[model samples]
Target: MPQHSPLDLAEGDPFGPHNLPYGVFTTSDEPQRRRVGVRYGAYVLDVHALAEAAGSAHAAVLSAGTLNPLLAAGRAIWSAVRAELVDALTDPARRVTVEPLLVPLADVALHLPFDVADYVDFYASEHHASNVGQIFRPNGDALTPNWKHLPIGYHGRAGTVVVSGTPVVRPAGQRKAPADAAPTFGPSQRLDIEAELGFVVGTPSTLGEPVPLDAFADHVFGVTLLNDWSARDIQAWEYVPLGPFLGKSFATSVSAWVTPLDALAHARTAPPRRDVPLLPYLDDSAAAEPGGFDIRLEVAINGHVVSRPPFSAMYWTAAQQLAHMTVNGASLRTGDLFASGTISGPRPEERGCLLELTWSGRDPVELPTGKRTFLEDGDEVTITAWAPGPDGVRVGLGEVTGKITGR
Candidate 1:
């Protein structure tokens, strides 16, 4: 269990001492240069000031506007800095020094924490994949032949990835009906959201080296909520030869705060059994260690709660994905982000997106705003999550929310 900080955190506070998540922010006082900060309760701790006050070696990096430098410092420095932060907040003697650096979170605007070098979205949830397969290919097997054998993934448009609360313009692409003689170009009719958890690479790797499963936490800094917006109708037309393109590249939203892997130690759970034999590279020998997290995730449309997807139900573990990604000797950068696909659970109520919940447009969900076959203009979708904390407490990953606008 984690010790209490000087700040009096509420019962379910996500930014407690145990979870001093990092982000970049700009206050009205100084909006020119973004500053690095740590979330604690409803306040943001000035990382640079805190580092200087504590006379820590990381002060220079903390003073920067983004987390990339700190991320590039590797695991040793990350551990040292986190330890210093824990002491600064929890130690009674440091109260006077730390108090001055605390700023109310509402007073600052959060920015993207790191510059994204690359982005990869993986289809790792069995229930979500099964549901999508069933809806799209009813005559085919729900589980693809190679799904259980490997983590299916695709490189995404990292440049277009936006922070939470950014408005998403409905994507426009060519769509053709079965009876239509030609494809029509218009704004997407079936805009949807995929609730996912994203992992950030902290340490870069060599070009010809593969990161082992045991070193998962050593390289990954933290996790955040991600919404991979999709266009179903456009995807249906173009995804035959290659996977998602314009249907997926328009915009993806992510929460600003990044909860470190250290904070989620208590939330880890064992993954489900695998159906296929694993290759040596994809082997998960850390069976006793946590392969999944018992994070309870929820999705809402226009303030109405609609789905509760469980992160623990994901078929492929983060460790496995990391190893598989590097098995081909692909190098990693400090800001590489890989996300778990829509994390739907085994039940109807747990579907992650409108596509599965509506059975591929056959069923429409009735929201308080109105019936939604797919998202309509002005409709905002938000995804939030909470995981088990030490001593039965709960820690949260704030949220990733976006509203749809006409293109």
Candidate 2:
């Protein structure tokens, strides 16, 4: 028999009882300073309250103040927290520490789990880059020279990172059509969204210390849905010898729950390879040892949103990204972020973002009702994920959604 979380997890559930991913949450009437909790079924199990109940079991670690403190304690403590919660909250036999913290996932508002110390968005998906490159530079190479040697990445603004539900105010920026023409300042007219996934680093690695591939799992705390809101016109004008500046800075949204790596352990599968041979550090085993996670990711638009299907079309895995991040000895603090840029597959139907789906505004996607071409006012974008199926259903990250309000 397969080992599973104590909870009744179906074959493809990502948050089965075995996985107690952490996050911060607050109610409509609660404070902005959040509390820790785990996702199970459709509820957020408040860990603080649970710790108070499991006094002896959660004693040593719970006294550390916040999940951030304990997260810094290393993987042993992480395992203990997850194990204790599974026994106490998921099982009725050990339900003594389970009351007072049970909040309906639907009722509460979720926040970014931790303060992101740093944000590094990587263009690690080969297919996505190729497709995009072909569209832009068809007569030339599909990928840049440096892309094959290392994980192409850019540092993003941590301050602009917001929780999923937070309203994404349309950003104001500069747009330049031709160098000959002076740039204009105004609210972004070409507002767009990029579907991405990022892993939260748990354990810290000092400056100049390389995080090896095998140990990448221990360094990763969990996964979250990321909607990298983009200003195409702005990004194009400023992003050159220097990458994304004001255009990609305004705001980035992430889902609340930290989907544990343990939950998706069974879903590992290697991504399709390309013709080029990867660099030594960026080898096959580093990307996908036997296989890495294959969680199905989805996206939707508006309240009566039309949802796209799931596909794990990432060119590189989180582990590989983590290893690459610290390859040059860059320190990875507890709240650091690493994003899998725009997950797009070979098929048009599997496209992950509006730029690709709409083919850079050339073809607009027809909603169930009508209208399309990038996002519009009152339009909401939602990103969701799970292992697969409904049998041993694990706690899902739910959905990270934002509406485009008029500037």
Q: Encode model 2's per-residue lDDT on 57-119: one tens digit a residue.
A: 655554432456666767887777777776776576764346446777777776677778899
Positional deviation of residue 245's Cα in model 2 after best superposition, in angstroms: 1.1
Error of 1 at 377 (Å): 0.8
RMSD vs true structure, all candidates: 2.8, 4.3
Score candidate 1 by TM-score against the native. 0.97
* Residue pair clashes in candidate 2: 5-18, 9-392, 10-391, 10-392, 10-393, 15-394, 15-395, 16-394, 208-329, 268-292
Cα displacement (Å) at residue 209, model 2 = 1.3
**Per-residue alpha-carbon lDDT of candidate 1 for residues 206-270, written as tens digits (9 for 90 to 100):** 99999988889889999999999999989889988899999999999999988888889899998
- Flag regions of model 2 displaced more than 4 Å: 1-15, 28-33, 57-66, 178-180, 286-288, 303-311, 389-395
